[model samples]
Target: MVSDRRYCRWPRSSRERTCISSIGPLLQPSSDALEKQFDSWQLRITPVDYLLGVADLTGELMRMCINSVGNGDIDTPFEVSQFLRQVYDGFSFIGNTGPYEVSKKLYTLKQSLAKVENACYALKVRGSEIPKHMLADVFSVKTEMIDQEDGIS
Candidate 1:
């Protein structure tokens, strides 16, 4: 009998597995999946690369928070807040042990985290006060504050 299930067989090569493993934790795969990946590949991810990838998560989080606010999504911001806190805690613990490259990423990660935090705070404190459409429209602004001198405008 021909089975209809997908993933009937694993990748034929470690290189293919390596490519798949490079997808990172953005999908938040379960521990079982991770175990399977490691067992299948018999490969260990590099710490610097892993840290860099983790650092990259902050940008995705910031965008998520922004979109959540724009969509009047109260729950997502809270969830993202908790996730960021966990990431921050982990970063603070090992941040100093990392290489110079990680330090650069740490700076960027901090900035992204702050932006998400502020967005969450705004949503929590002002969510009820602001109309849904107005809140959503807030994300659609084309020109950033030109007076700030950030040159985003």
Candidate 2:
């Protein structure tokens, strides 16, 4: 684990988690892959770190799903929908057992999962009716809902 990575004030403790966080897209939101990442990186990932990393992955998944929808790729969003559902389920089990920070991240993760689901729904339901050129515009505007909820610009 690189000692340079920072997360709030838990600097030293977040090293492994920081490494895990960077591998989100590479793992494609798979918990198994996350474990593999810890092994590959020669670091031990705690359940809290793993869950936090997965929570971070959901944000990436949302971006990918929204981009896929704009690009008119139906399959990607569909697969993302399933992946997010699994992540959500796994996270639900954590419930209130996780630390305060994990709870905060989980809240954001839920919002991201919801946005991804909505994007998938649009792709499977209303996507065909919308013109291709207008797809990007629609998704760009709609994805702001996520940005708004997350307080991202």
Candidate 3:
């Protein structure tokens, strides 16, 4: 068996995580593809790093949902919400047993999912009442109010 110390050389720093998160969307590779690429380049990454990068992606997806809504795309928010729910469900299976970095990202992931869900809820319930052009603004204000109430900001 490989010793745990062999894995210790992989940096757990936030800078490394930020780099990993940025690269993921550009290449958009599957996990297997990423593993193969890393092997070819003689680089190492832990499972926890992969999970953290995925968690960071939820925040980007949340932004995409809001931007798509602003651009008058009514379908993207629901689609993103569904995707985020699946990711959240997957993370839920990991529970509190993950590394501290992985566990910490779960809250951010949940927050991203919540924002998408809120946008979706608004679109569904008030689509008829609100003008299409103003929908994004309404969603932003509603999200901000929720953040304030939740003591997040």
Candidate 4:
């Protein structure tokens, strides 16, 4: 009699396992499921590519946090901050050994994390003083100040 239980194999390298496991829950699908789906579509992505994509996700999440604030939703920024921090921690495992491209994105990822943290800071500090409708304006001013300080404009 054959048992119905399935034996699964995880990636051999702790790094690959960390990268896949880190991104899995944020994507709302397990890494195994994503792999199966990609396989069915004949798609392939190296671990480096996957890490790069997740790094890029930080920027999108930053935008989302800001948009949530614009809509007067005060809680999402903190949630995004928590998620971004987890992503950042996962990347820390790669450290200086990651590819040059990933290294470059790590700098960007830090910047995105900082922006979200700053937004959350502003909300926590000034939230009580500002009206709900004007919170977006406050975020815009804060972003402008940050951009100017960074010499982006």
Among the numbered candidates, top TM-score falls to 3
lDDT string for model 2 (71-145, tens) is 766676667677678878887777778798787877887887777777777666887898866877777777787
Clashing pairs in model 3, backbone N/Cα/C closer than 3 A: none
- Per-residue lDDT over 1-153 for candidate 1, one digit per residue giving the tens place of the 0 to 100 score: 011111221233423422123333323433577677765433344678667766676566667667877776767666666667778777877776778877777766666666666666667787778787687555434113311333332
Alpha-carbon lDDT, every model: 0.59, 0.66, 0.73, 0.73
The global Cα lDDT (0 to 1) of model 1 is 0.59
Point out where model 2 deviates above 4 Å.
1-42, 146-153
Score every model by TM-score: 0.63, 0.66, 0.71, 0.69
Residue 23 shift from truth in candidate 3, angstroms? 4.9
* Clash number by candidate, in order: 0, 0, 0, 0
Q: lDDT rank, highest first? A: 3, 4, 2, 1
How many angstroms is residue 22 displaced in model 3 relative to the true structure, after the best TM-score fit? 8.8
Candidate 4 deviant stretches above 4 angstroms: 1-43
- TM-score, model 2 to reference: 0.66
Candidate 2 steric clashes: 0
> Which should have the higher lDDT, number 1 or number 4?
4
* lDDT at 129, model 1: 84
What candidate 1 gets wrong by more than 4 Å, as runs, is 1-39, 137-153
**C-alpha-based local distance difference test score of model 4:** 0.73
